[model samples]
Target: MASQPEQRSKVARRALLGTALCAGLVATLLTTGPARADHRDDAWTVSAPAAHEPTAHIRLDDTTGTVSLSVTRRGRTVIEPSPVGIVTEQADLSEGLRFLHRKDRLVDERYRAKSGKRLDRRVRMNETRLSFATPTGARLDLVVRASADGVAYRYVLPGGYGAVLGETSAFNLPPDASAWLGAYRVDNEGQFAQYTAATAPTGEYSDQALFETDGGYTLLAESDLTGDYSGARLAHDQGTGTYRIELADDRVQADGPLATPWRAMVTGDLATVTRSTFTDDLAPASKVPDGSWIKPGTVLWTWLAGGREAGQSLAAQKAYVDYAAERNWPYEAVDAGWYFKAGEWDTTDPDWQTNSWMPELVDYARAKGVGIIVWIHQRELDTPEERAQWLPTLERWGVKGVKIDFMDSEAQPMLRWYDAVLAETAAHHLMVDFHGSTLPKGIQRTWPHVMTLEGVAGEEKRTNTAAHLTTLPFTRNVIGSMDFTPGAFQRVGLRPNSDAAEVGLTVAYESGLQMFAGTPESYDRRPLARAYFDQVPAAWDDTRLLTGRPGREAVLARRGGDRWFLGGVYAGAARTAEVPLTVGPGRWLVETVEDGADGLVRNRRVLRGGDTFAVEVVANGGFAGIACRWRPGVTTCHR
Candidate 1:
């Protein structure tokens, strides 16, 4: 057995030798291959002999330098430097060890510092290594390894500031070779019991990936804390067969944060290989489930003003219902105050339970074809006494869903209380919306009834600006569906106040059940925007990343059947962005973006097979619903 220092020294030499051997092996197998370019202009390219195989080559080029990586079957990649200027430094070897009872091998690795900062240490393993070479010719190497199920990755840089990100065994599972990735944060006191339960069934081979890319950082957990999975956020891609989890926070990080590193057992099954990445504002690409009871594109109403107070007069309540009916919006919500008095100190009156305005409002909304959701504080229902008092009453009201609010952040008891809330809600065949809460783990996958959460600083806060709205999609939204209360008809702020264009942005954003928060009268005033909202579907069958950089600008294209909706948003300043519409080869009837100048503009244009179109858009402003219909013959059209 080699000493740790000896092993560290052998890594670079061994890697080079291994690469030579692999290259030779490949040559022996094939005489003719794809033409290899010795040198070419910079671009990032990935190549794999076949999709089913585990090996691949990745090339990255930037103004600073170029990085080339060769990934092997065992989840290890070798990086080589290109002739570009980027400085790299090395640090002292720091070793960390983790033991996994399932896999017999001891995952051992030494850490290195690249930036002389412990937090920025680069983790590398025997099979997995990261290196950097500055165009100036400086290089740094980071090495890592795994002990059975545990991983030992090291970050190496120039300074003495280096620490190994290691994990100690706290929980165990039976051995299984399935890849599982989750976006989760480590809550010292367990809160995610259900999450733990979900991963436990997969056996001990499950490696939980925790990340803090949304600014606040935490460890990803394999099990639940107390009863709630506090650190986890909602995200689209929870690794396939392997559980993929996401962690989220509302506070924005200056630079994009690192998502929890993916951890999964190596398997031939592509579905079993869990993969994920962290982004400031990235939404999931998957569609919400479909069923008669739970359909996509349904609008939920929330009666935030005390139901009795807001709808005190039947005429007033009926007016709102009439507004919904006229607008074709589907549902209505009876928020918090409806359960008790709006401002009274002694609000909880046991006798006043059924006599509230909720029942009447529910009946009226039902007759108007609008569904009603009730609001309940989680604290009130934390115990058996609370649950006994509230659950039955809510079920009896025949409410569509309950918006649970004011959940405690770190308390284990509160976590457990939330889990019970979901179970109880599901048992009653009711849907749920978590408010004043954190990001979602993968609970929705197991309990598809849970719709959205208000972890974001949505429109409710009158101070929210366009920057906040623009930032949410890339940062907070990356986790999962956020009930951002998108449609705010009121204009509260200054220059970048919420407007029809902003409303259009929200519709373009993803959500399972969207809430249109504002007086229906406000929506009626903006008919064009209203028409666009009418077109916005709650769930999307497919999503494509059109163009734009993170935060600065983003343009997204989504589709439900043959219809395509395109939206673009800019954060700080007004700028022009080129959006590439290249989903498929088909002629599209394009609308000449109506910027509120002329009545809705429409243009008939035909696109040829295998062609790309570039559309120019302005800054701080965006284009939406420039509808595209597949036209087979029509060619050029006047702009």
Candidate 2:
């Protein structure tokens, strides 16, 4: 007889093969569902029952592969995906549904109270049918609704409770082919709290995504609520795959009165491929679309050189702006201490008076065709007094945005306070970038004006080495936008050195708004590297994932019309790999090779019509920004 271990291995292999077969069959069947339709001006659609029917309909644009899920009942469009595309959609009927895996079967169901009040029933995992009660005192059976676009698992609510809470999770695979999950929360207007847990097969908390809804028609919050669970929290365990979500909200909260609908997307797989593809699917389907809400480029600022009093460093500020303007970059930033050094929470610092030089920096940037964003510490802006006084003044000074830093932790009060800040900033037409903060949990979608947040120890931390840069996209970026100060051309210490290659890595790592955080002279020293910076936009209309492996290697492709940008990084030792180019049809001019101490090896080449290209690259060292143009009938070659 075979040994026990051998038998177990055989069994595991068989199970894996069986699961693969099942997955393939399911994918085939799903692909045959309804073909993607074109975008039409149809009435909005709501989650009304089949009896009442959908009074309105949401049209999907096949060209852009964008879906418009509208709420017809209220005559309002609740949520629209980003111009990119929809990743995935998962649905559930009721809250508190327990999922159980038995030896032979997988049981998932929920229950309700005898009085039809709340979900106060139990779900048992046994060799029986999955059952749950409706709010109208009726028992309903669950069914699977699969489609080509995605799978939709539906259920009926008991009673006259027309409210439904569904969790839809989407995913995108970037150039690196790393997976990122985008989870969405859908529920009627009500007080709802959704809890997401990413656990391993053993059910350990690898990550957590949460959203609390007050009351609104839409299911997903436009901006993430600032509180204990404001940012997307990651799991300490790096190997978590399985995720579970639980949502709870009374019908009263579901109603439109003092309640708002709940909606959210949660995932921690920040590989470039996942985010790019997911963003592509979620984008809105509209001709002449306006992406002003999505800030896609990098910011050139003089923070590190002058520190808190960067605004006082007028020469440095002017030089930075000149560098950005010369490169055709969009914006430059002036960090804190420009206003006044009112010890922590001192908003009344006399320096904030009309005589401050920060406002002059903003004006100077504007004159140079560059936008200026100032930084403000949270302690000063937390109170109503400070908000009313300073926010208006900052807006009056023509500040494009404010980087609110030092938001201590993930507490409920802090979350609420952050929410208020976002709201107030929006009121003043001032964009926000939360720094010294927590992770992002899809808040930028609603308040598109909220540019970026600093959750991870980004480029600002000079200690960030090339190795650390390789680990970020797969981890912190999975949740949402990271305000990582990208461009740094100075070589400081040994282990964690900053150079033009690192600046190139910033664009490659998939940051929406990149902050050029080095001396102005550094940028001047590297014009070719600066050329890449000039081309990098703060916002993107479409993103594509080419290839990647979490904490190891990642490659991404982003598109801004005719121009194409490709970036990749490797965290471990030197290695080689092939990455695919998925930016539609075109001849790509690739100017790339590993950068070493001596200089760049002239390996500028051209790539013709091909799906995937085999390229040799080093570990920790990577390639970025391959500018491609359509050269019909011409093959690309090394220069």
Candidate 3:
């Protein structure tokens, strides 16, 4: 029965207790741990239990007070150097720092994720912090926590350090590292391009990029992002195979002390990185205790190829709702132009820009067991004045959420707007899906209702390929939910998919809104396809990327409502692979779908102690999915 203030006080106390624990560990490490004494004379070296992770150590330069990370596997150094920070302060912080104190400890912490495959929400890390200050009074701390599977670190800027111009944190990889940068090309339609550290273009922005080194794989991402800083992009350094932080804005000014976003890396195993909730761990725990209304389910997009008329007219919207309701889909999205006529949205005369059909359409959809979501230009919701009036108005209209698009920037102001909108929408108990925005940096961890984001080269693209499909799991989607706007069974497009491939897209991509980009008429033809989506979930309880080759193949397993839906994509001539799955030991009733050369075919089988299964995909074709359930120990976790 504690108030909010009391809860906050307890959190502060816990943080102090953690700090104390860290200090005690520091002494233990310095005196008794198997640390190289020369590290203090040269660079303070850090490690986590094994040799395969030779390059995963964090190195702190004692003299310069600079921190960088390098990971090695099998004697090969994969990440040579990735600097942690570069703050512009009056006093010298680069060198001549009199070491103040240090902390080292084993950290164990856990919290519940608002919505995700809620497994292993906690992390046990080998933690440490090196506190340093200058005689001129500049003080800072380089704190790092490394686990057997991942590593996260941040720079703590004490309030007295004057103003910070910005950061110079950079990731410098080795030549052999392969990276998948979001939106590598394709005229910004949202698609990822896979490249090597030696080949990725410079000056380009990627939400989060991956480095496949001999040391395993390193998923580099930003976490627990707060403050006035702009979004961080990986600007490639071709010659040195490094990436520097090209912040969206020049500087972030704060009156109080600020801790930069955690520069996190998960390197070791692909599944270890793939299944990580570390980013969510960095964010504060969910605020909503009873989030029953924050529904995560498939929604139909009216603007998917064709629906503008259907989106605007009460009759057409009703038809779409009929389809959605029949399939048990919870919501439908009305994209662009439903609110007001084109070019008249900002008219001082509100009636000129308003649409009269919206109210009736909302009622029609609501009566049919479906909720309505409208799309808005993000710029329209940038201000409190705009949101205060608009949000309440939308709430009154019975809308569930809004898809706000055209962000196109990662500047500090844009970052501020991101939080502001989420806060307002949350207050009104409405959901938000961001588009034309950069990749999500654990924002959903803080605001669960802030569902999916369009930072990847998703299905909305004029064209999408199996290659793009394969690349997503390794790059665009690892940090948080990605709204690819899937389901393109339209039988046309530069990169159209087979019925099976489309099913695979639904399983592969995780979003707050699992939308089938194809129209109802298109899906209706393939009742089997509709049946797959009818039972699939927008979010999952757990996920496993069984086998994949970037731009070549991806096989994945997702659990929903206690059942597992397994899917995969193969862009080449029909070939088969043994897909590994992590299922609890049991007997399972498995229902499968695969490409039947011209279309998709479905069948069922029973599996015992489900581990790995073999399947084939047609050349340039793929397997959509197969539904599986434990016959003995049934668990409807999401129902």
Candidate 4:
């Protein structure tokens, strides 16, 4: 095996090789010297693939050498001109630079996503590279890609290396724009709130900063985040309606030519924003050796209900495993106390002297076709040696997956460690669920084995309400899979939502690895809820936003296999939500679960594609259901 430094050298070599491949594809406009250019020549524009898609215009201030951009959907402004630049250790590329040359290309490609809103996707973009030289002649390139859904740009240094100090990038919202944003937390667990851009608090915000603009909606996010660069957040300037780029770390080193993560903004109406695949489109292709072993499904988790005691108890785990097998759930997660104490990783804690029974439980679960996912704190596998020492051992024990928690950082080292862990986990054919982690940047596309991530304030947070729960679909979950472990039959969080609302979340919130948070007894008590869970899928082949808003209400219909599941959540006052059945025209058998005057109710009906499925709700209520296309002679609908 090669040393860490040697592996990094190989990565650098691969990056250089990629750079070489890019050079061949790029048609560079070369110049013998600094060309004196007019303001007209300073601007370049690109439109998305479709006629109605968003268009981006990039303009360079020839005098200050600073670049800025503006965007529009249809004819209305989506973004006011926003500044873009970067500051490095050796030179300041933000201003006082010279125009060198540029390149342009049209990119169109198709790929298969192992899981997400859509199983297959087409990435079409108009790519433009604007090159510049600092006062010291250091090269900087602003690469922009305009797609049908939105536009994204990133900084690249062709032969650049050294410390990246900061960036001058900013997203300028229109004066009347109202923003929905979450505060930045190491675990990325913050509730989203609404405020006018000027009134938005001046502080760090999670990467997925969404705005309801004058024209439509726009969601700010980043993609292709590698460990080579630190994670970034939006630093809002109160009263200015401008969000500046803030790196998670003070300094990040670029060992080779640095290609920063794509600063993406997905634009359009609520449906467009919710259904866009721009994040996955911008990520790299799959890197796993074979994705056949990777499975996405629901897992019965004991920690949330039974806590550490049940998680470590062999009897408790065996019981949970038995329930999982009975329910046909693919896995059961044992959190925290199953291993050593939080900080002590090398040796088992004296409290759990008989922890060796984990292997026995793994065998027991495997016999029933259930996999066991064990949790470990971040410190346990902080280094490659620790990961190497433990990963194979767990595989040998027949453990199918790992739930690594408390990462809480996206600095260069931690980011690199994330990449390394995903790679290593895939090599061992172990699925991974990252908890206490940063918002996913489409890593699932690069490593399909990355089943899920806990970047939102999920069921674990006591402060959660229907308002916070309802906002996630448009904000946090838009970018990638979220492990917001749904299905809590017991009342949870601060102002509790209706039980029907909890049932609705199983389908509304998308996660490749959805963990049922309720206890076996809780689920057993609610037969209807259990029935809904039994049919809902973690991954989808197609998804559509049937109707609703961000924090108030959200109704989504997702297709998995031959069934389309509908889930809707409402935060405030009660009203009737009418969702159009747009899945296609045919005799459809619909089974719905919703809040009744009593506890909960289930109803079955038949509807055609053009018909509407309306449900009456109480305040802070919700609904979940399944629709199957039925044949004329079919005797029964499976789900």
Off by over 4 Å in 1: 1-292, 300-314, 345-347, 408-410, 462-468, 492-500, 592-594, 597-619, 626-628, 631-639
* Number of the top-ranking candidate, with lDDT as the measure: 4
TM-score of each: 0.57, 0.60, 0.86, 0.92
lDDT of each: 0.43, 0.46, 0.68, 0.82
lDDT of 3 by residue, 1-639 (tens): 642223433444354345432344334324432232223533455555444443346555665656566655556665676765544433334444545556788767776554554533765666677766543445667777666666677777655444454555667777667777664321233566678887876556464677887667878788877545556666665555877665555545655666777877766667767767767666666665556678887988878656555555667777888889998899988887665545466324566225457777889888989998888887678788888767888888888988889977776677778768877888888888888875667777778887878877677666777777787777667788788887767746545566677787888777777767878877888777888888887777778877777778777788765677777777666777666656666767666677775577875555675566667666666665554555556432123
| lDDT of model 1, residue 205 | 20
lDDT of 2 by residue, 455-484 (tens): 665655545546556545544454456676
Query: Candidate 4 on 1-639: residue-level lDDT in tens?
Result: 642223433454454445432332232322322455333477888788789778888887878877888898887888888988776555556766666667889889898877778788888998988777654455678898888788999998754445777777888987568888899998899889888888987778988988988669999999999898999888776787888778887778877778999999999999989998898888898998679988888899888779988866889899999999999999899988776445454255443424578889999999999999999887878898878877887888888889999999989899999988888888888989999997778788898888888989888788887888889999888898888887777744443588888889988888888899998888888888987888788889999998878888988899998889988899998888787888888779888899898777987778888788779888999999888887676543444
Model 3: CA > 4 A from native: 1-56, 60-65, 72-78, 89-92, 105-107, 160-163, 183-190, 205-207, 346-348, 351-355, 610-612, 627-639
Candidate 2 lDDT for residue 107 = 31
> Model 2, stretches more than 4 Å misplaced?
1-273, 276-296, 341-351, 462-468, 491-501, 611-619, 630-639
Worst 10 residues of 2 by lDDT: 82-91
Least accurate stretch of 10 residues (summed lDDT) in model 3?
A: 29-38
Model 1 local distance difference test score = 0.43
By the TM-score metric, which is better: model 2 or model 4? 4
TM-score of 4: 0.92
Deviation from truth (RMSD, Å), model 3: 9.0
**Each prediction's number of clashing residue pairs:** 60, 76, 13, 0
- Give the candidate number with the greatest TM-score: 4
